[model samples]
Target: MELDFILSKEEKGPSGKTELIYDLAIIGGGPAGMTAAVYAARKKINTLLISKDLGGQVLWTTEVENYMGYQYIEGRQLMDKFKEQVRHFPIDQEIGEEIEKLDKGEKFFSRNSDGEIS
Candidate 1:
């Protein structure tokens, strides 16, 4: 998967905004999706991670300590760290965006509610 275009605010405003193309279009930004973004970006793939929320599943938890390196930390705190790490790369992250559809092509395409392509 590869991202071919990033819908600019101007483009989205005029096109009835729809569809996006990406090398890797991850639908969620939980630990899994964010982690994938980190790896995909490291490999130099055009990656886009669009999620309704940044920390999926894990955000609801009060505490988490079993993962690694940290003796104890809140779930939100850990997820924040994960997000920060992924941000170190050139991954295109779209938060608070809900994916209405995903069409796989030579490149993956995603459409959000605002008709903007990610």
Candidate 2:
């Protein structure tokens, strides 16, 4: 069955102002992190997914057969499906940077590489 929902444009808050703290902060964009983003965003919880790459190890695989849907599918194809699902929600995705540390506060802070704090 096909499902439909409105996808609202992400609203930009004040510049440099941290908003509400997320219920969860996922630090990888493999299958696990992507899945978590899908679930948390659906539940209307503030969620942030930080990863250097979106697909992670899954992007390197050429073929996957044990995933239970098709007998076989290209690894990139599978990752694409995951990414499509993730785009449906307001999950925050930061790419191309490694997470150095996580600071818990009213609004969580994630420090990226290059010593350029965020």
Candidate 3:
């Protein structure tokens, strides 16, 4: 059965199936995840970023002092910059949704919080 959800525009294959493939799938939108996305994009890899929301624990931080390039920056501001950098690349994002399950086989299959697979 086909899932009703469309993860991304490139998800549908010639057979009309949601067969999107990616060289990397970052499960969170935290500082680490965002960094990984940027690196993967720089490497010209087909990448997907899935997260309930961006920023992660960093969003809760009031001030960011160790984030390089800036002596001090607000957490939100830092996250915004990260978001902007990630968006500048050709990376696929699935934000505002949580992954309910991940099945590993010849390929990885992920089910979102809404029970939709992509």
Candidate 4:
């Protein structure tokens, strides 16, 4: 399977820098995180989703048979379905990237110092 770093919106600042403003920031690309991002986007919230990999452990699984919807499904295939839904929205993703440092200011959430969000 091919894992692409799906993304858009460069968001360069005055000096070609990135902005550090987001109403929502998701740090994982698992089912839960993706679901959160989908919900946030549906609400028209400014959100950024960063993750080292898209499927996480789910991609390593040989088969997922217990899930309600489908009778049987391969891990990679299921993940692709999730990815399809995710791609339907304008969700920004930082694939193959990990959060190195996190700093919280006087604000509500912290920014990704490495420009993952900031």
Candidate 5:
């Protein structure tokens, strides 16, 4: 299943059949997940990030002050910046997809919509 990432123009893929493969597959889009995406891109890895939404717990909070580079920032605003930074890389992302299950595998995850890994 060579599904297209909506925000990206590149048709190149790490997707086919019932599963997709990447040098890295990040399972969230929170501060940590987005940050991992950035690092993976820098390392030139074929990466995928699957998330229900961006920001995770950070988005619900009213303010952010602990993150580096900003003494004070709104949670939503911080997430926006993270999203923007992720756009600059060749990363595959699936948004608004809630994962019901995931399991350990050789590459880490081998998943199906029905929550099976094969």
Candidate 6:
């Protein structure tokens, strides 16, 4: 797993607008969301990860048995691993934020809890 590029926080054009364009936007920081981010990054896709927190339902479990490679691992520990893997990539993150609205047309846009549209 090797990537040849490191992306800036946002892509700016000659006019210097701070708007960011992503090839993919993943909502949630759970196992599924984190997994998607990893895959997207591996493909060199510009990605955005939005979530209120890192762990989801899996955080409530005391032990996980069916998660491959580990016979028995703590919920938090598993989530930590997922987080680590996700951080290894240059995926954009919006943790602790929630999407309020989403619009689709010529381009897709979303408004987060802070009222800032992206």
Best by TM-score: 3
TM-score of each: 0.70, 0.74, 0.77, 0.73, 0.71, 0.77
Q: Name the candidate that leads on lDDT.
A: 3
Please list the residue runs of candidate 3 whose C-alpha ends up more than 4 Å from where it truly belongs after superposition: 1-18, 114-118
> Which parts of model 2 are misplaced by more than 4 Å?
1-20, 103-108
Pairs in clash, predicted candidate 4: 13-17
Window of ten residues with lowest summed lDDT in model 1 = 6-15
What is the overall TM-score of model 4 with all chains considered together? 0.73
lDDT of 3 by residue, 9-33 (tens): 3465557866766667788899999
Query: What is the C-alpha lDDT profile of model 2 across 1-118, one tens digit per residue?
Result: 0011223224334575433445566789999999988998998877778789999898999999979788999989999999999999998766776877766654345667775545
For candidate 1, lDDT tens digit of each residue in 1-118?
A: 2235543222232347644455666778889999998998999877878788988999999998767898888999999999789879988777887878767765455677887764
Kindly report which residue stretches of model 5 are placed more than 4 angstroms away from their true locations once superposed. Answer: 1-20, 104-118
lDDT digits (tens) for residues 1-118 of candidate 5: 2322233234333454234445566777898999999998998777888888988998998998877899999999999998999999988888876666655533344355666654
State each candidate's clash count: 6, 0, 0, 1, 2, 0
User: In candidate 6, what residue range of length 10 has the lowest lDDT sum?
Assistant: 1-10
Query: Per-model C-alpha lDDT, please?
Result: 0.75, 0.74, 0.79, 0.72, 0.73, 0.78
Candidate 6 per-residue C-alpha lDDT over 40-114 given as tens digits, one digit per residue, 9 for 90 to 100: 999988888888899888899999997899999999999999998888998988888887777764556677878
Pairs of residues clashing in candidate 3: none
Compose the digit string of candidate 4's lDDT tens values, residues 60-89.
988999787988999999989989899999
In candidate 6, which residue ranges exceed 4 Å CA deviation? 1-16, 113-118
Positional deviation of residue 102's Cα in model 5 after best superposition, in angstroms: 2.0
